[model samples]
Target: MAALAWLLIPLFAAIGAGLWGSWANRNRKTAGDGIELAGYTRFREAMEKPDAVVEPEPHSGG
Candidate 1:
């Protein structure tokens, strides 16, 4: 009985892992690009714009 219980531990663990994996991989976005990809593309476009510029402020020493 003790040996059986020990063996069952791995069986349960495997079952739980399989269930979690399936749940995680369940499909959703079959259409256009995903949100992260779209956001990254927009960010890239904004960064590439010439009008967008950054100016640094001068620091004063005490």
Candidate 2:
């Protein structure tokens, strides 16, 4: 019974630590803020600039 209790103490501690870490990071924001708006702005700018070639297909056939 003593050996079983010793083993379970560390197992429970590890489970508690994992739960705490996940809860701590729940509200964090990533680096891609305003990404959609920025992409649209760049696309519009590329269309307006005459020197830039807005190719119909940017990717070549593999």
Candidate 3:
């Protein structure tokens, strides 16, 4: 019983720490917001452009 309690104490503490960190970081602003917004506008414009050819990259033989 004592051994099981010792194992579970650290496990529960780790879980609690992870949950706290995630909650703290939930409201932060990310760096790519402006880039994403610009990309969205460009995508909308591309939809209206007739000559846009979406090309798939040739896969390099990994």
Candidate 4:
């Protein structure tokens, strides 16, 4: 009947939402932070270097 079909819509939606939530939350472990930390250290070292000297512009006569 039309009422039965309408009732099924939410039931199906709840099942689908539960399955999607489980799939979305299933965790996979990260390999390690060694590589990422090393890269971050290099980035910090590069950023700490002194700024390069800028040459003064020659005076221009008006």
For model 2, residues 1-62, the per-residue Cα lDDT tens digits are: 99999999999999999999999979877777599889999999988887865658676678
The whole-model lDDT of each prediction reads 0.91, 0.89, 0.92, 0.94
TM-score of each: 0.46, 0.43, 0.43, 0.59
Candidate 3: what lDDT? Answer: 0.92
Clashing pairs in 2: none
Estimate candidate 1's alpha-carbon lDDT, on a 0 to 1 scale. Answer: 0.91
Instruction: Name the candidate that leads on TM-score.
Output: 4
Question: Per-residue alpha-carbon lDDT of model 1 for 1-62, expressed as tens digits?
Answer: 99999999999999999999999999976766687799999999998888856787877866
lDDT of candidate 4 over 1-62, digit per residue (tens): 99999999999999999999999999978879999999999999989989777999988977
Tens-digit lDDT track of model 3 for 1-62: 99999999999999999999999889866696799999999999988889867898999989
Task: Give the per-residue Cα lDDT of candidate 1 at 25.
Answer: 93
- On lDDT, who's better, 1 or 4? 4
Clashing pairs in 1: none
Q: Between prediction 1 and prediction 4, which has the larger TM-score?
A: 4
The whole-model C-alpha lDDT of candidate 4 against the native structure comes to 0.94
- By TM-score, the better pick of 3 and 4 is 4
- How high is the lDDT of residue 17 in model 3? 100
Q: Worst lDDT window (10 residues) for model 4?
A: 45-54
> Roughly what TM-score does model 2 have, to 2 decimal places?
0.43
